[model samples]
Structures are given as C-alpha cells and as structure tokens.
Target: MSCNAASAAGPRIVSMNVCSDQLVLSLADPDQILGLSRCSRAAGQPGPAAKARTSPRLSGGAEDVLLLKPDLVVVSLFDKRATRDLLKAHGLSLVEFTVPRTLDEVKDQIRAMGDVLQHPQRAQADIARLDAAVAQVRAVASAHHYRVLPLERRGFVAGDSSLISSLLAATGLTNAAGELGLGAGGFASLEAIVQLRPDFILVSEAGNHAEDEGRAFLLHPALERFYPEGKRIVLPERLTVCGGVMLADALDRLTEELKRVTR
Candidate 1:
C-alpha cells in the first residue's frame, strides 16, 4: 500500500464524507483518489474544494462506488446505513471515522488515516503541521482568559465539549455557552445571548446582514448592538464545520483574530 511505488500501487480510495474527503485528498496519492462525495464541493475547505473539482464526484449510492472498484472506501459513521451495507455486501473494504471532538482525537485520526492509506509519511507530515498550530494556540490561550461563545446559525451554540471549544479553551478562552446551561449545546434566544455577556461570540462568517431566517436570527438588532464587527470573530464554516487538516490553518487564523481583538 506504499505510495512510494513507482507504478502507483497504493489503494484506490473513494471518500464518502466531506471530512474524510479532506483527509483522503491530503493523505492519499492523487492516483489513489477514485472519487469524492458531492458534499466536498459545497462545504469543504477551499484547498480540498479545488482538488476535488479535478476528481470525480460521487453520489451516496453504491452504484457509482461499485463502478470505481476502489480498494478502500473511506466513510464517516454518519453516512447512510443502507449504502454502507450495500458496499459491504459487494465485498468492498470500508474504513469508517467518527467526528473528532478533541485535539487528541484529531491527532489520532490523522495517524489512523495514514495507516489506513499505508502512507505513513503523509500522516506524520499532517500531524507535524497541526502540532505547530497547536503550540501557537496554547501559547495565546496561556496568556489571556477570555470567554467566547461559539454561536452558529439560528443562535445554536457549540458547547464546551466540542472540538472547536477545545481549540478555544487551549488558547485560554472560556466557553461562554456553559454559563447559559449549554454545556452540551442548545439554541439561545436573542435576549439570552445578550444577557450571557461573553467577551466575544465566534461565528462562521462576518457581517450582520440577514440572508435568510437562520441568518436573520444572528443578525437581530440585539446581537448587532453588542457584538459588532470588532466583537464578532469570524472563523470560516469550512474550517470549523469539520475537524481535519484544515483545522491547523483554522488555528492560525484564530490566533491572528485573537491578537487583533485583544489589542
């Protein structure tokens, strides 16, 4: 399964989830990637998005995957159960992953994918890359203690147990969601958001304009009055939506944003 073989002897891989798509695109050799799920196109990070476009897009159905005849099919635990059973019935090898909720899981996943792909070098490289970001985040967190509420569409919060919260806590930001009885995450009313009174609310995008009802909830006048441009930290949804190699870059972006706001 080594990617080093001159004739590309590595496993032909089809990734079923956008998150696994990112990992596969990063760790697997180009020839090893047989297909990527359509989710990657709309929600994956820009880097993975670009690569995915050049590769074949797949439906969740077993038909397309059967055509590819991939040696290994990378999937998420969240993928459709029927699809997985169909693939298994055909004797296709499958590797499943769950969402990483902590830095430890993050590291474990990279290493695991590397082993699964038989590309140890690629996995180690990704881990090394993430470790540098981890160090930077830890350094910043150690310096200051700010409370940050990870606010999302419809005022839903990412609880303290989330991967992003772990990343935030490493940088010394307290998860304000906990104070509002959202340790495991739940929606908050506009009034509840204002009253909770955190130092900042981390969002997936910038602006206070409403594109739809969900967006409108976040753009409510009450939120804008308190958490304006300088107050709302915009971390792109691509990075935070999935826990993968993209998070290393996300961590760097957060460090810069934190520095700017703290100053």
Candidate 2:
C-alpha cells in the first residue's frame, strides 16, 4: 500500500473496476494482486482476474483497498469519485484510466496499462490476437452481402465513438444506428430504430433480460416486430463492454451469426 519509489518497483496492484480488474489480473502475477473489487468474484458475472478470484475475494472500497497495502491501484473513470478520493487520501499510488469508447481507445488503454505494468509483451500479444481476429472477420464478411446493426437496448445503442461501432467497422459490418445519426450511449427511441430497418439485430444475451429496464430500448416490442424475420445476434456484455482478448471471442461469435443470417 505504501512504498517509497526506490523500493516500489513491481509493487502489488489492486483493481477497483470490473473491466480493469480483469485486465490487471490477466497481466499480473498471482502474488502481485493485493485485492479486487467485490463484484469480481460473483458467480456467472464477467469478473476479476480468474486466478486471484479462485481463492478468497477482496471487497472493493477505499477502506478494503487501503488495508491491502498495494503499491499501485488501478481505477476507472466509472468508479465513484469518493472512492478514488479516499484512496488518494490514504497515500496510495493510483493510476486513473478512462473507459474507452472506440476501438483505438481500447487498444490505447491496453497498451497504456501494459506500459504502466511493464508488461508490454503481454499487451502486444493480446493486441496482435485481436488484430488477427478482426482481419478474419473482415475477410469473411466482405464476401458476404448482409450488413449488421450493433443493437443494444439495455439503455443505449452503439453510436459514433463507441467500441461497438469500432468493432462493427473492423468486421466489415454496417451499423444502421450511426446511419440514423444517433450520437452516443443512452436510450434510443423505438421509432428511430425501426426506421433504420437493419438487416440483423444484435442484443445483449446477458444483463437484465427485462424488457422494461436498463437496456429496454433494444428489446422494445417494436424491434421484435420490425426484425422478426431478420437475423438476430445475441452477445454477452463483457465482450463489447471493453476491448481485450474477449473481444476476439465475441467477434468469432458475431462472424458465425452474420454468416448464418446472411446465408
């Protein structure tokens, strides 16, 4: 938790956000993990570093994190300001990372984390794998004719600067929402979505499946009616939430669905 820089090199690290928790755990040694957020250990949720979470878990909060005595703490912009301020007040060395909206931003974040962690090799390897996956999807999609609409109704649709939009472009799929001129993350009206009339619909396979809650705009009755006969792609939130190795996994699923729907 507190170490002079002279002796702090390669100090223990803790991640406070789910996405960052996963990424840091993936890149760090097991002994290097000080603790993780509470959400990381939840069953059936995309979570903290798998290895670190396999044993007992650490609760995510300023007090819990301070108790761990980590050398560096990775916090996301999405984390509460109070949590961050408390940790800083405790004299913990912290690095704040922005939630990436575009693919470039995602890659940049990965590399930046890699740089901070001194694990450039691991980061490079992951990025290379992602690049290969994107290329593979693009090749297969180019020969096909059907386009895709990266739809998310759990509140918002993928728009101009989002990672979903970046991946759609990488895979050679067209995004109908952007064509309709929606700006960013938030609810998209049903009428606006139907007017786009995309060739296929992509919806979250997980999250609250309720039609009335956080992402209900994507699950509106009108959407079902509009795309009843078209292809549908169901994706897990983690894949599209942040860009990382899991993205390739999501894209593979996407490529398979796109091929099926297009055929």
TM-score: which candidate is best? 1
lDDT tens readout by residue for model 1, 145-217: 7888999999899898899888887666788998999888889988899999898899988865688999888
Give model 2's TM-score versus the native structure: 0.84
Q: How does candidate 1 fare on TM-score?
A: 0.92
C-alpha RMSD values across all candidates: 2.5, 3.4
> Which regions of candidate 2 deviate over 4 angstroms?
1-9, 47-49, 144-146, 206-222
Per-model tally of clashing residue pairs: 2, 7
The lDDT for every candidate, in the order shown, is: 0.84, 0.71
- What would the per-residue lDDT of candidate 2 be over residues 80-191, giving only the tens digit for each residue? 8998999888898889888777777777877877876778888888788778888888887866544566666453667767788778877777766667667564566677
Q: Which stretches of candidate 1 lie over 4 Å from their true place?
A: 1-8, 43-47
What's the TM-score of each model vs. the native? Answer: 0.92, 0.84
